[model samples]
Target: MGEELKLLGAWANPFSRRVEIALKIKGVEYEYLDGDIIHNKSALLLEYNPVHKKMPVLVHNGKPIAESLMILEYIDETWKDNPILPRDPYKRAMARFWAKFLDEKCVPALWKYCWSLGEEQENAYEEACGVLKILEGELEDKKFFGGNNLGFVDITANSVGLWIVVIQEAGGFNILTPDKFPRLCKWAEEFRSCPVVKENLPPRDRLYALFKARFEKISGSKDAELASRH
Candidate 1:
């Protein structure tokens, strides 16, 4: 064998899903270690990503790469068969730009949804919507951000949708209502419905229970709905 490839990730993370999707699209076989670091982090996580110590660390041939975006580029370059990003220098740079926008602007709100219910929570919700709205504008007549197919930006931006329903229920907020953002709503539907992504999604009930419990902990008896579960 050439070398063993491994991925350390948590189930609910969109960041982690980026790496997972890239691997699948590339047809790269790898071992997945899904242990949430929010509660219990694995030694592999610490050893692989010492600095930020975040999840979705890809270990290739014993060398580790931290940060999901970096890993996305590495995956694209390493396995060039099913191209995710554009080949042209300018187009590739543009894809990176949009990916950066999604990573920075939209990803955090999903995690922060729970434990926030006041003005701060409200602001977070709006900003999150605003981020998606920007993308909607950019995708005016395009099927995918990559133009014809699901490209790097599509996978990266769509990662956050994994826990959207859970985050909404846990945080007691709704930003991407099916009625409000039709384009985005449709895009989310298409994104998840895709074979590669649909295959790897976590169970809804499991994520709901997990997020609800975590939400209860953070807000501390503030959420009446979760209290009903008790």
Candidate 2:
């Protein structure tokens, strides 16, 4: 008999979506438990990830794994039919490096740029574009970040390829225009059109609405805080 697999995730979270895509690509059957990480988290989520208390925790046969990237690796390793990482040691290392880079550098910069205002937002936007240029250079002639396949780096960059469009649309920004970064822009379109990716992605209109509401809430809170200080 197969082991019980359950994924604790939030619908709008790109990190959680990454795991969902990986599972789909691997053809792994698992139960998805949508958690309200923003408002009220479930006891299972707290129990699984007490330290970080974050979503995208994978529960397999009663054992829990936290962090989306780690969960991706775990899923890849546990179900080796459709391997996500390269077989060559050096190539595998490179893939892991790029994935970590996307998580630490690109994701944070994009998030900050979207949420912040004035000078902070400008700085973050510049930083994100600079990083994206580096990624574009890395892409060079490759179809995806992991060559032809939607491998580790491609999966990790879903935030840039998929979610960023909704974020830009909702926030009324143009950070990922064709004129500025043609290669990245093209890559984004191609990435989203992939069979696995396209099938798993959240609806653009729905994502835009969700982000719009969140952005308003954040801006309203900032306005309230500023008003209180006066």
lDDT of 1 by residue, 1-230 (tens): 57689999988777888889889999999999898858776677788888988898999999999898999999999988998989999999999998888877766654454346677776666667777678778877677777868889988875555577566776677777767767666777777889998877777788788878877776776676678989
**Pairs in clash, predicted candidate 2:** none
Clashing pairs in 1: none
TM-score per model over all chains: 0.88, 0.94
Candidate 1 segments exceeding 4 Å error: 109-115, 221-230
Report the error of model 2 at residue 1, Å. 1.9
Residues forming the 10-long window of minimal summed lDDT in candidate 1: 106-115
Candidate 2 runs further than 4 Å off: 222-230
Worst 10 residues of 2 by lDDT: 117-126
TM-score of 2: 0.94
**What are the root-mean-square deviations of the candidates from the true structure over C-alphas?**
3.8, 1.5
Q: Quick one: best lDDT, which candidate?
A: 2
lDDT for residue 177 in candidate 2, whole number 0-100: 83
